[model samples]
Target: MARPTIYSDDIANTICEQIAEGRSLRSICLDEAMPAKSTVFAWLADSGRDDFRTKYVHAREAQADVLVDEMTDIADDGSNDWMEQKNS
Candidate 1:
């Protein structure tokens, strides 16, 4: 199916939700049901889309937090950082 061009509150919310869940806009746009990346960027550039832009910004901030938490978890994990040694 062709991606959506005309923006809607539902679509905007869906995009924001996924973004907050640590998904990239490029990946989200790859979905056949979502809008193209250019379309999303156009929405951001459009002055009339202040609300959507605000939501998108907040979602990105949340995504950053999620990424930081994941990084911390990975850094804290040393399960694979060492290898077992055997006596000769």
Candidate 2:
């Protein structure tokens, strides 16, 4: 019996990209004619690239939140100063 061929990084990346784009794993596998769903998952898990992607996404979201808070503070600063003057 012939052994099944292992998928390459390019193929795995395509699968991951498709998933990130909202394609279901079953749909991708069926469209791509992939041998098994587990194979795609294994590729993603083994590559260690997903971990970095997750970390990057989280960091970017945190940065955005911080920027929004800073902008809010700047916008409120004048109002706060006016209120203090009125109170005094």
Candidate 3:
């Protein structure tokens, strides 16, 4: 099936949701269910899509926060610090 080009709240929300979930727009756009990256960019560029643009920006910020949290968790975890190489 062809990807959707028409702007809709559902599609906009889906894009933002994926972004918030730490998925890249490029990757999301690759999905058959989503529009092309250029189309998404166009949506962002459109002045009339202020709501979607806001949501998209917030989603990106949220994704960054999630990445930082994951990094912090990895740094705090000491379970792997005790691992030593075994002699063959």
Candidate 4:
């Protein structure tokens, strides 16, 4: 007999939460207890359940927001002459 898959609702939700917090799937898969990258991709590929798929997409968008925020902070640091030169 083959071993049953060990995925669970709690694990899925936790992954979604991490995604919402801006953690990439690659990083999530790096954790000791997290699912494998293939498993997570399988979840994203399954059309029957929109829950995980939707969460994953939204989480990617959240990561973009994080990137923009970081860029804004760096641009506003006021310690650089790059902006002055650009505006000149």
CA lDDT, every prediction?
0.96, 0.58, 0.92, 0.76
Candidate 4 lDDT over 1-88, as tens digits, reads: 3322466777888887787776787888778688788887777787866877787777778878887888899888878744435555
Name the candidate, 2 or 3, with the larger TM-score value.
Answer: 3
Clashing pairs in 4: none
| Candidate 1 residue pairs in clash (backbone atoms < 3 Å) | none
Ranking by TM-score: 1, 3, 4, 2
Indicate which candidate wins on TM-score.
1
Top model by lDDT, which number? 1
Compared with the true structure, model 2 gives a TM-score of 0.41
Please give, for residues 1-88, the per-residue lDDT of candidate 3 as tens digits: 9999989899999999988988888999999989998899999999999999999999999999988898999999998787679899
Clashes of each: 0, 0, 0, 0
- Residue-level lDDT of model 1, residues 1-88, one tens digit each, is 6789998999999999999999999999989999999999999999999999999999999999999999999999998698889999
Model 2 alpha-carbon drift over 4 Å, by segment: 1-5, 44-88
Model 2 error, position 40 (Å): 1.8
lDDT of 1 at 52: 99
Residue pairs with backbone atoms closer than 3 Å in model 2 (clashes) = none
**TM-score of each model, in listed order:** 0.91, 0.41, 0.83, 0.70
Better of 1 and 2 by TM-score: 1
